[model samples]
Target: MLTEELLTLAAAAGAAVATAAGTDAWEGLRTRLGGWLGRGDARGGEGALAELDAGAAELLADGTPTRAELERYGAAWRDRVITTLERLDGPEREEAAAELHRLVEREPAAREVRGGDQHVQGGIRVHAEQGSLAAALINGGVSFSPPPPPVRPEG
Candidate 1:
């Protein structure tokens, strides 16, 4: 098992990767991250790309990922990251961590708007909170909450 800090880092990386899907940054991210996760192995990189694509496809089909679904993906990738890191020596692990950090830092902020914010891929559109978008595609699922109270001008 990874230490608490490492697990957190893995989860963050997973979330960042998830957020980058279906965006302009996705292709570059997909290739670079796949290469990293694959440890320079072409087959491994391809596998990673497939996984990323499948997740994006799922989101497109469902329209939004449910909270549970996003968590599932996050957990899945987190475990993968942890496993990959575990196999590395100290220096390699540090380098991987640095790379992951860079990836996370580069992710765009999430948008809460309704229209243009949707991520379109292969002509399929999906709308959800930015970072949380990965899990927005819960089939037949809908979430509702009261809108925030309007702000009043200072008296």
Candidate 2:
């Protein structure tokens, strides 16, 4: 059974893969991911590479993908990563998770969200990125909480 941490790592890796696709990072990421999934098997590595390339092609088929498309691809890759992790043994699984975590950290999109103020209400936060608009509708009573004051370093 995969641990919660490993599962989260796999999900992040999937998102990273989706984000890296069609970008300059795609080549390096694809090669690393293929090797990670391959686990010393050349045929497995080639298969993984092919699958990743196909996914990238599909994602970029329409030039710029929509948010929905990115989510869809991310979910598919997440499932694939989860399945891969589930099939691995203990040490290998840990190693793979670590590698995936590193990849995700290195991915620009996976690392940060650059945009406007994020508002959290009822434990839900809405984020808007550059050249994008995001809106959330909440039924029932809505409360607006002021953001916490920034901490100042004491001299």
Give me the overall lDDT of model 1: 0.68
Expressed as tens digits, the lDDT of each residue in 1-155 for candidate 1 is 55665666677767755666567877877777788788878899889889878877776577667767766776677678888989987788888877766665565532211112344333343656856644344455345667689999999
TM-score of 2: 0.70
Q: How close is candidate 1 to the true structure, as a TM-score?
A: 0.61
Models, CA RMSD each: 13.6, 12.1
Task: Note the Cα lDDT for every prediction shown.
Answer: 0.68, 0.79
> Highest lDDT among the candidates is held by which one?
2
Ten contiguous residues with the weakest lDDT in model 2? 112-121
Model 2, 5-41: lDDT tens digits are: 7766666777778888888899998998898888789
Winner by TM-score: 2
> TM-score, each model?
0.61, 0.70
Those runs of model 1 whose alpha carbons end farther than 4 Å from true positions after fitting are 108-155
